[model samples]
Target: METKREKFYMMNSMLCLLKVVEGKRTTVEMRDEKEVTGVIKHVDGYMNISMEDVVFKSLTGKKKFDKFFVNGKTIRYVHIPDEINMKSAMEAKLKEMCTYTASMRVRQEIKDQAWAKLKQKERRAKAEIKKERK
Candidate 1:
């Protein structure tokens, strides 16, 4: 029941929203001449954003409202640099690889330690039982 133009617009909006989520920082301007700036932590489907000090929830049927806290109808604009995006992507990949390698090493070490401890305990128990029997 949707037209091609509507689908295109929806896709474009989704892309824009993703870019905003991946953005390093966002600029939130309220109607009360107050501006909030910080890294966007999370965003919901309703256009709500969690910033440093404040949480923004989109208002319905309101272009702009008064009072920074109650003003739900504010503009949330985010600008991300291409270089930052590339850098973040590379950093993420590197961190993932490092985490995987470290996890594998830790798991191996834990298994080895557990096996060694079990063997030592078994030996000690066997020696104690033999001594008791004698």
Candidate 2:
């Protein structure tokens, strides 16, 4: 079971990784220390991002491409712009909190119902054993 704090952090990170940085001129540092700078074209739920007019730089040299697709798993760091609007980000976080809370409640209810059914079966079995003894 994930603690509430863990869930909150996960949600916040998702928002930052997906919604907060879309269409922004950003830099992504790969695990191999190569850096790519471009405008974000698209990002999937998995965090795999597509960028346009991308430039890749390393210790040796730099190369520019018309378009590039990066696997999320290989990404080490994503550098977002400093001038992001916090008001909108807070509003989006509130909305996501509501949605996440509702979904978690539904999951808890399902687990509770399953446990109740299992308990009821155990009681019926015990009752049957007592009846047989009588």
Candidate 3:
């Protein structure tokens, strides 16, 4: 069997940074000059955000909301709490969120088992061909 060497890729990206601030208080400045301060509840791959206890502020006025959603495209800037160190936060969040989930692990195990069984059958077939040749 030939072993494939894979290149190492770090999970370093803006969404990775956003994942660190999940369930934490943060501020998002919108492109339209609105600002939202709240606890970030969720951040998806597209950078779309769901927040709780949101306070939306604009030049016109301020509004409070129990929950809010921010489109990824409309976001201009994000303010993560100063207490959260970027390096440490990214490391911790990546460790927690980047690993395969239990379901994924199970699926991978099934795939490997199937591949092994297939290989074993192929080897047995080759062995039988050799016996016939003898």
Candidate 4:
């Protein structure tokens, strides 16, 4: 029987792996011990992964093996390391979001200022006409 702490660790590890796959380009080590270093292109029904550049679809509809097949289990599911360096990618995304938010705020501010100015001009024009009529 697995302990609760063990189950929690497994869940956390799974979530971390999913984040790694979805977040940025990563290298995964297969069960065969093959260190496949490439961006994860896609994951299939059987959890089989197609890595970019490193793994190729041959003309015969077979996967071509690279130099290192560590444990000879063919191609096992890819495993990303517990920790991935995603600082730059995260920073770039955050910066993009901040820039978009800032641009929207600036646009709204400009619109508000323009509308206020227009209203003030209209009020001044109306007052001038009234004074002339008096």
- How many clashing pairs does model 3 include? 0
Of the two candidates 3 and 4, the one with more favorable TM-score, higher being better, is: 3
Error of 4 at 90 (Å): 0.8
Model 4 per-residue lDDT tens digits across residues 49-76: 5555454333344354432222223555
**Candidate 4 local distance difference test against the native:** 0.52
What TM-score against the true fold does each predicted structure earn? 0.36, 0.56, 0.70, 0.40
Better of 3 and 4 by lDDT: 3
Best-fitting candidate, scored by lDDT: 3
Model 3 clashing residue pairs (backbone): none
- lDDT per residue as tens, model 2, 2-38: 4566456646565334556778899999999899999
Per-residue lDDT for 12-129 in model 3, tens only? 3657788778889989999999999999998777678999999999999999999999999999999989988998878776776546445567899999999999999999999999
Consecutive 10-residue window with the lowest summed lDDT within model 4: 64-73
Q: Model 2, residue 128: displacement in angstroms?
A: 49
RMSD of each: 11.8, 6.1, 7.0, 12.7
Backbone clashes, each candidate? 0, 0, 0, 0
Stretches off by above 4 angstroms in model 4 are 1-85
Estimate the overall C-alpha local distance difference test score of candidate 2: 0.80
Error of 1 at 43 (Å): 9.2
Q: Model 3 Cα displacement at 118 (Å)? A: 11
